[model samples]
Target chain A: MNERYSRQTLFPAIGEEGQKKIRKKHVLIIGAGALGSGNAEVMTRAGIGKLTIVDRDYVEESNLQRQQLYTEEDVFEKMPKAAVAEKRLRAINSETDIAAVITDATPDRLEELVQTVDLIIDSTDNFETRMAINDISQKYQIPWIYGACVGSYGMSLTIIPGMTPCLHCLLKKIPIQGMTCDTGGIIAPAVQMVIAHQTAEALKILVEDWDAIRTTFTSFDLWGNQYTNIKIAKAKDDGCLSCGEARTYPFLQNENLMKTTVLCGRDTVQVRPPAKQQLDLARLSEQMQASGYQIKGNPYLISVEMKPQRIVVFNDGRALIHGTKDLSQAKAIYNRLLG
Target chain B: MNKLLFFAHLKDEAGAETLSIDVSGKTIAELKTIVSEQHGLTKIDSVMTAINEEFAEDDDIIQQGDTIAFIPPVSGG
Candidate 1:
């Protein structure tokens, strides 16, 4: 264990006994963005024995402002966020075993990843991923803490599978396209405060101090001087799609997912569905005919051609929508029409 | 009459942590217009309306003594 945790261990609640337990626990943190960086740093320093850091995106200059793990050199190298965080965390505390996985958390990947860790901590930027994690945690009966931030505010909640209400219990349904740091612009302090709370709750859980973990969802704003705690002790609602019926709606199972690539200098879009789903070739060709599109390829991989718009669909329900710079809008379109 | 509790940015915009609005046999949409008239919320896209801590749909009816809230999009970890 790291000597840096000695001061924290001195506390009666987390004495040597608790420190030992903490050192044996393995925590998995998803998302190596702002919140994940702070969380990984704190947990590693606090001497959590094993750490698994996962993130898909690489570090960029914009991330240095609040993502405490990466440096200018890392941004220059264009290293993945999880890899950068693992390198920094190893320097911070070699006693903690740090492993980095650079990949997106789709439903297929989650089943493999969730089984390896004792707990899950959310640092995802979007609601879809967060809800996915929430569902996975509840299904596996594993504890996961949800954390998020934007502007000068942050929020956190400790979800202990069977004990407290999960994320769906607190918010009846997903909000209608909430704003993000990319849109709203977040500050550094707000990220830190929420990460601090998550790390604290994580510590309590790691130390096996179930009594010390917070039961309510907490929110605060650094610039606004506001603090509020929403109680979520209620049982999972029967109406909730995920937690209510214990249904594990795997996101990867959705046929709308597409694997696409943009042509070197061409603009187009492509979409494909699984082999079992009828493609309605006549109907699809009719819709594309008006747009001057040519349908090509066999049933395995359908290639659609239009004036400047191009799209490709595979048998496994993969797609590539071209001519658009925004990925969210593309995914939304896929979900709307194909899902 | 109903009590409306605000959290995060909604609380900041309202300038008060908590307040009340009187509405009898009114739908949430109608009450929103009344509240907007007083609070000058001519543009209402950013905030989400909830009743008793649960999100309320636009057509959901609002009765007296119900707890109403306007929640701004929040960010926290």
Candidate 2:
């Protein structure tokens, strides 16, 4: 309607009609890291009616190389990624309603979020969450694009329910413990490659351009100059636990996920209390200050600086222990600080 | 003989992006074992395989002169 999307509307594939369709769509982006930030920015600027972004971590210096939504000030203030994304996206386009959630994207939370959204985008850093999203995508019959990157490699697949093979069908036979950015390192271009494919697919789906949606799963190695798109629509299996004839949706259950786990390539471990609790940040900050702990915080979370380790506590009884991937050490630190 | 290709970390593990190997008549599973041993791709057992750009099923046979690629999934933001 406004001049905001005139350039996009001029594109032959997505004319004024497509732009109007996109304006009526709502997208749910899981994980507010690099992929999440990129997707959120494009969707907002493209004039998507609504965007709900979910992320648990905060901005760190290491993230600046690729994650474009955050700034040095966010890292200094220890602002959560979702909080900063919400602040930044609102400033970018005030018309688009943005809901940035600062919490873990557990299966239960994902199902709740998916109920009101038209599409889901996978920008997460772990298979656990991806599998959950996949199962949810299958269960709800919603379309979602899967994107991942590590080192100089990136890949994407668009999964449409009842039309294409789901992620579970694609990788059902393979053992999934593989490389992460922390182990193999990554480049900014790799992240961008995934964003490009994912954004294109998102736009096509939002505009109801079903014919243009890629039927193949795309993978590439920019450093090696290698690329391929596999036609796996025939790979769909009737026995898939997530999308098959006997659908079990194993990942939808809560037991499959853990309360404490190491973050992907972050050198960090996250710990969540067994039962959710409403933590008072002001009271916690006061108590920490009284105890001589160097504290910095906002209304949503608090940060306590420790030697060689920093603890970030959120209102939902979760803490991210930075500077270590040792699960036990992180749990011990969480107990000591938030107990 | 068959043409073998590797992607992502698989290329590094295999020491080359493409390799021409003599596997006159071998199933995809048998070929996987051979390549995994030859290239020391420890995760080959779990990695997904593609034959000529189509996902190879367990029973798919590798015909002579066919192209194969081993793809390992990466999960990092």
Candidate 3:
């Protein structure tokens, strides 16, 4: 054991034996945003053996405020979040084998990745991805820690396949809707709090300390100074779909999946076509130019600049419409141009 | 008077963290209506309520001195 983890080993709960267990555990973190960065740092420092970070987006100036692993240099270089995070984590602890995959997490990809890891961490910003992760976790019977933060409030829950209620069960009562961080605004303290809770639970799971894992739904508002732990032990029953006896994985079924999502902290909305289609950027740029829209094109993406809005379309039929947060407005532009 | 607490965006919408109201015997649904009317919030029904740190349903009664918190759904990383 390296002296780097001496302090953590001193803690009786994680004494030497727990440290060894942590070094042998493999963790898969879904998002490389604020919560994901914080969780990755903690786990890496604690000597987690291996970690894989997956993210679709690149680092931006706004991300520096809350995302700990990123710096202004990363934004200037247009560095992908997962790659930069992996670099930083490896620097912190070279003993930990860290890998970064820069791509959107689809159900098929997650199903394959979840099999290789002991635990999954939910740091994704959207409910769609979270639900998919829940389905994957339940299907593989792997435990995962769920964490989310917006403004000065945050919440976390640990989902153990057979022992506790899954996220679907909790969502049945408190359906997550409306008021994203882009609209609501977030602070760093709330992000830290949620990640702390998630990291603690992750360590417990890695050490197989089932007794210390919290089964309740915990939420807190730092600005308001209030904390609550709702009893969710009885929330999951035989009737529940994800973790129940029937085991119907609706989120993974590819039905009613959203085509557009408003990106957090960016005045941008992402539109992904339901079915994958290859786009020709040069031809799209030529069409946009002929249509009286100012256009710029690279091999990978085509950018169309209109008055007050810019649409950046990628080759995979995914477009990020800047200068708008409204889903309808973004979809309308995408449909009119791309369809 | 029941002490009502607002959190996250709800606090920003209400413009205060705590609001004291004389709704001792009122149900959570009635209290939501009162708070909505007073604060000009349209989606009061979407917010979750907690009385004295325990999750409370819309039909739960609000007693005197109970700290009622209205929490909006937060889905950010």
Candidate 4:
């Protein structure tokens, strides 16, 4: 065992033998936001073998409040979250192989990554991505931990495929008027509390301690001073569309995926055109420049400043339309500018 | 009295985390209507019902001292 992990190895539950298991495990974290960054730091320090951190956003000044892995320099440089996270995580534990993927978590991308990872951690801020993670977990028979927090409340669930109830069995659909971090706001303590539970679950799974894993849906409100652990082991619906006997995997299906989404807490909307369309950033930049739009970009992305709203387009036919969260208005901008 | 609990944004909508209502033999649907009227929540239908930490259907009967939680969807990470 590495001298750095000596303290962890001293722990009885993850003594030398269990530490060996953790040293050989691979974890794929979906988002690089608050929960994702926190989980990455904890898991990396715990000596996980390989970590793949994926995110589609860049570091912002506001992110410094709760996202611990980033610094003011990263925000000033407008660094892509995955890359900065990978750099920080590598410095934390060089022995762990870290891969920073800069792209959205579409079903096809998740399918390819799931084949290589042992487990997944859900730290995304949208229901669409959570549904996708649930589908991938069920279809591949891999285990996943779902964690979310907003305001002073946090909730989490562990889905072990056939053994426990998946997220769908818990909440059939996202409430139409559900509040997001953007609308409702969030506290740093809540994010820390949720990630603490998630990282502990991740460690148990990596150490192959199935018995120690939590089987209930756990939630707590710090300000309200309330905690609830609802038994969700029996909530597994045999007729569930995602994890049922037939295993429809509707979220993984191409038709069910959204092409555009209003990002939470950012007042931005993301537009993902069909996968078949490969965007030519150079050509788009030339056209935008000709139209008097100030454009700046590298090979991966191009940003166009159009007065109040700025549009950043990626190579994979995805655009982040800033200054608005209306899906219809974003779609209209994408159609007029990119199409 | 049935103890009704609200979590996340549901707490914001209800203006309280918990409330005690003097109703017995009322189904989850009937309870939702009464609670919505009392709390002035327009989206009561979207809140999921759980009886004593177990998810219950709209038709599930609410008995005295039963703890019901109205949970709205949470999507923050």
Give me the candidate number with maximum lDDT: 2
i-RMS of candidate 4: 3.8
lDDT by residue for model 4 over A1-339, one digit each (tens)? 568899999999899998999989999999899999999999999989999998888898878989999999999999999999999999999999999998878789999988978889998887777888999999998999999887788888888887888988777764333445644568999999999999999988999898999987788888888888777666678888999887788888887665788888998999885453456677667657755679999999999886578889888868899998877556545644642
Find the 10 residues in a row with the least total lDDT in model 1 chain A: A269-278
Which tens-of-lDDT digit does each residue in A80-122 have in candidate 2? 9999999999999998999999877888889899998889999
Highest DockQ against the true fold, candidate? 4
In angstroms, how far off is A196's CA in candidate 1? 1.3
Worst window of 10 by summed lDDT in candidate 2 chain A: A173-182
Model 1 per-residue lDDT tens digits across residues A1-339: 346777987798999998988888889998898999998999898888899887777887978899998899998998888988998899999899998998877666777888867888888775556777888887788899989887787788898876777776655444432445644568999998988899889988887899999876676777868776655554346666566665544333454233334435655444333233434444344444433457777656556653244556555556676666444445434432232
Which residue pairs does candidate 3 place in steric collision?
none
Chain A of model 2 scored by TM-score: 0.78
Over the stretch A1-339, how does candidate 3's per-residue lDDT look in tens digits? 568999999999999999999999999999898999999999898899999998877898878999999999999999999999999999999999999988778787898788779999998777667888998898998999899887788999999998988887756432322444654568999999999899999999999999999877788988878787877665566777788888888778765354889999999999886556566567557646755678888999988886578999888878999999988567645644542
Q: Deviation in angstroms for A151 in model 3?
A: 1.9
User: TM-score of chain A, model 1?
Assistant: 0.76
Q: Where in model 1 is the C-alpha error above 4 Å? A: A1-3, A245-339, B1-3, B9-20, B24-68, B73-77
Please provide, for model 1 over B34-53, each residue's C-alpha lDDT reduced to its tens digit, 9 standing for 90 to 100.
76777644334445566665
Error of 1 at B41 (Å): 6.2
Clashing pairs for model 2 are none
